[model samples]
Target: MTGHVRPYRSYVYAYPHKTAYRPLPEPGPALRDLWRDERKDALSLYLHIPFCEVRCGFCNLFTRIGAPDELTGRYLDALDRQATAVRDALGDTAPVRFANAAFGGGTPTFLEAAELERLCDIAEKRMGADLRAIPLSVEASPATATADRLAVLAERGTTRLSLGVQSFVDEEARAAVRPQRRADVDAALARIRDARIPVLNIDLIYGIDGQTPASWRTSLDAALAWQPEELYLYPLYVRPLTGLARRTAVTDRDWDEQRLSLYRQGRDHLLAHGYEQVSMRMFRRPGAPAQGPDDHACQTDGMIGLGCGARSYTSTLHYSFDYAVDMGHIRAIIDAYTGTEDFTRAVHGRYVDGDEARRRHLLQSLLQARGMPLADYRDRFGAEPYDDFPAELAAFAARGWLDDDAPDGLLRLSPEGLAHSDALGPELFSAEVRAAMAAYAVK
Candidate 1:
């Protein structure tokens, strides 16, 4: 435990923070120019809902605990406005086609059944995205994943429903400050199964204070009972501004070793249960219904995001409304988002240069279990990944993390490397991006 290495840095999910984004001085025209020559064959649509029933202790996402009365309605109205503005900006030149759609955030299902219907309508009617033609995914929480709400989502062509169930043991959940009963979780699973959605993804967390290997196994078994289409095992990080941050420090190496061991245990358990390891944290049941559109992927395609916390991406810029973790800041951003009339230009984002784009391609590919196809990298960037990222690739190989000699010219992670994905992802961040992210004010 004393010498164990853990992932202590930032979670490198998306590149850059809203802090890196500056106001577009020209607004509408600037956005039009940015999207002028961008590829529009396969674009992803993301709609964010920033409200939650309760903020989990280990959570540090851009979402508020609860919305005041009428806030949800107003938020939808604002989303409609933004969608209209964005569509008009794309105009006739950008023949954008929706390849996939997802509703994410604190919890999209937190809205009432009727509101959820309206949410879908905005994406379909206002944004011109055919939700029924493409794969649609939505996130849900046990307390908010009501039957009526699930029905609304299912009716709107939701192919996959992901539910977050951190732990099956009530004590472990309480230790994580999640505050859920096993019975409620079980009931939620039952309801999700009854929803008859094409796919179900169950999310679990490891490394909670009181969670042991045995308890982790118990939760895994409980989740497996439903035979979910996908399972995402997340390692809990107590980040600043989160409820658990005040109670725990991020510099605990002993906890790192505990998490490493638990991760291995859980990974092995899921593998033995006939689940295929998709990455360090994701497992898919073979033959499960597909989750997203096959044509579009985050690695190359553009995305249009609506709602306060949602981040949209073009080839050059990734933009979003102001990002914040503290409740006060989140509420302020949401309020401002709901009040804004102009949505043509980016408000906050970091620019992606050629180098940054290369790095993004590598990070998006290398961190997965399927690994990066060397041929594909060369084809996209016109340069070999090893040549561009020589030092990083060599260091990873020396650390026994990457296998450079895989067949078909593929670069993939070893089993040990997969376990250290959290560390590897942050290590790939460029110095400039790292500095920008580090300088961001969490609140």
Candidate 2:
């Protein structure tokens, strides 16, 4: 056994983070070539709004504080221009069928009610995506989940609304540097219910400084009061430039153990409340509708990401605008994105070779509650995942993290393995990718 101890938060194996991405030498032609023969049956659409009311202490996402009075309009104008160019670039690939759609980042609802409506128009009218025909998910914050915004979303076929309520206790929220009141969270929940969206997902955090088990339960129980369709319990992570990182003084191992304990408590609590464990962090009530098949399953299909922070995925490359954790750098990128007229090409991305593709498929599937199917792997790659990643799989099995002897021939994670998913994910990363990510400039 290696006896390594990782932070136990989510791992970085090619989703969300853009640290490994490099500038494409031939952006336009490269994208065209990548998408030339790509499947058009089903695709996922993502639109990012990189503006937020406040920057939380633990946030390392690509978002800036609330836009100035006229900035939102200018951003939207840029988005429209990019959408038109992207649609045009698709050429014959223009009318690809989209199975899922989402508006995320910072806060999609941070826009005014009218702006929200226009945002939907851009998705439908400009991008040629039929939001009404597919499941649509949008992210919001307690402070911004306003009545008018929710109404526009509901009318525009937003099936799910996810709210970031890191904690229900006002004191704990303050401790985490996430400014909000319990009353505001409750009010937002009520408004969401009133909007009659099919699903309501609540996001909570554990392992914050000065947080106790009692405090965690208080937050969890308060969230359960609404019987939310989905609940996500995230472990607090203090990255290099985040507010929490500047103030945090805890040892990594100690924090990891505390987070592990909290994760177990939260998982067991949700299971007792008739919620199914979708993964280490996600819980779903018994009768809640699934959040669309294509939402998280991007390995099999293509994705078109529409704003500055969003990343578009082809079969072999994932591309996005420049990525940064510092506010100044993020602003610079957003400013550059707003002025750009050409959306026909990819500027920054990482290429996925055959080996990398296999690794992605394995990582994405194995990390979920559903194990990776041996037959499916063989069908896709003409060889079992075990054949390609024998050492990694064997090591996990030896560590009691995998069910190597499952009768179904599926590679599944044991409970202990699930608990150590963060560690496992990085171990699967290619050395080259890891070095590239490590060398990335944080600011």
Report the number of the highest-lDDT candidate.
Answer: 2
Summarize candidate 1's per-residue lDDT along 1-443 as a digit string, tens digits: 12344554455566554555555454433567667788877888899999999999999888888888799999999999998988887778657788888999989998999999999999999888998889999999999988999989988899999999999999989988888899999888888889899899999999898787888999999999999999998888888889999888655778878888888999999999899988777899999987663211444547888888887788888877677788888888889988898887776777788898888888778877888888888999999988998988777787778765677689999888888887877777889987877677668
What lDDT would each prediction earn against the true structure? 0.83, 0.84
Instruction: Identify the runs in model 2 with alpha carbons over 4 angstroms from their true place.
Output: 1-4, 7-10, 13-17, 26-30, 93-95, 294-300, 404-407
TM per model?
A: 0.96, 0.96
Off by over 4 Å in 1: 1-5, 17-29, 293-300
Distance from true location, Cα of 428 in model 1, Å: 1.3
| Tens digit of per-residue lDDT, candidate 2, span 364-428 | 88877667888878988999887799899888888888865665968888888877788788778
Clash totals in order: 1, 0
